[model samples]
Target: MRNYQPATLKKNVRLASKFAYWLDCELSEMTSANVEDYLIHLHQQGRSAKTIKNHRSAIKVFCDFLGTRGILQDNPVLRVPSMELPEEIPIFLTDEEVDKLMVIARLDDMFCEVTLALNTGLRMEEMRRLEWRDIDLKFKQLTVRKSKSKRPRTVPLNQRTCKALETQRERYGHLVYVFPGGKGGFYNRGIWTEPKMRSENWWQKLSIRHIQEVIPSLKNLPAGRTGRGWHDLRHTF
Candidate 1:
């Protein structure tokens, strides 16, 4: 729990529960072979390497807990081999794709968010938490205080990003969040009534789906290319 986020903790708990349910015998009878077999089962189910790794981690933690309480003489999960993930190439949008995306974004009233994402390479959560107070337009810089690393950093603004911010300011500068949610709050995960509503998760998925429809290459990406989120915009930057 020291380093785990709330979401991660919940996921680990869920995975551990599933692993326990899969074992026919008592918890004390569980072994490394069982853990390995479960991993193989996950692989057979077409779960991605990253997902299997997470499952393995949760099982390890569960086994460690059992060992600490003398439920097991040894931690069986320790004997399980670590999962090896295949190399993944980062995918970014082509210049042409960006051009088309920008045109569509402008029409959809997402120009500011798209512009900031491409230019600053900020994560969706970081952008969602952005507020007017964190930006210094006079100095052309903004502070990301709630970054994934939990460390604040300053990001410089280019002319394009500055212009986009100026436009956003003129429109919704009085709001607390730079990109307020549908109800004028921080962006949250959910469907919205209007496409212009800014929900980072939904927006990324919607945009990617639209782009894939327009860009044949994206729809025909080779195996192992798996980017369907706003992080792709960061990579594009």
Candidate 2:
């Protein structure tokens, strides 16, 4: 935990915690079967391939580290079958699709968020929590303080990103969060959930409806229960 970045440490810690609960036994009692079962459990939960891969990596790293310290007889992860993942290639929108997406994003009042994702390749979670201070428009850069790798990174902003961010500053810079929902509150991460999708006035629903209308194939894109909206924008970048 001390060696890992914040996000990586959190993921590893969560993996340990969940594995402990699932095994209901000491570290020495863990076995390859237990690891396999945990992977199956994650699959059953509708976790994406990337998410399950992360979990597997966390568990493998944890077990290997402990095993070297004489805390266990074997690394169970090594004995478990490797996860069969689909192709690593991500779906991306072409220039025409992007132009259409941007038009719809504007109509749906999500232009800033959509544009930021396309320019920065930020994850949905990262974008949801971004603040005004994170962007340094003068330098044409934005800092991702809380990244999946635990290490912070500053992404360079292009002319399009800078322009969009400048516009966003005029609209939302006074607030603490760039995308506030309630009084001085950040947007809920579950805004794209099935329940929220049913809302007649939710911004996500409006944006999604328009985007799918423009790119009908997106409606059939395979995503888990959480669905993939702006994530494809990141890929498009």
Best-performing candidate as measured by lDDT: 1
Q: Write the per-residue lDDT of candidate 1 for residues 139-223, one digit (tens) a residue.
A: 9999998676878999999998999999888767767777766642123222122324245454644455666666664665432
The alpha-carbon deviation from the true structure for residue 55 of candidate 2, after best TM-score superposition, in angstroms, is: 6.8
| Residue 9 in model 2: lDDT | 77
Which ranges of candidate 1 are over 4 A from the true structure? 6-14, 25-29, 61-75, 183-200, 220-227
Q: Report backbone clashes per prediction.
A: 0, 0
Clash-forming residue pairs, model 1: none
Residues 134-198, model 2: lDDT tens digits: 88988999888877776789999999989988887786666666665532112333222221112
Sequence-dependent TM-score of model 1: 0.78
Candidates' C-alpha lDDT: 0.76, 0.71
Estimated TM-score for each candidate: 0.78, 0.63
Evaluated at residue 142, the lDDT of candidate 1 is 100
Report lDDT (Cα) of residue 108, candidate 1. Answer: 58
In model 2, pairs of residues that clash are none
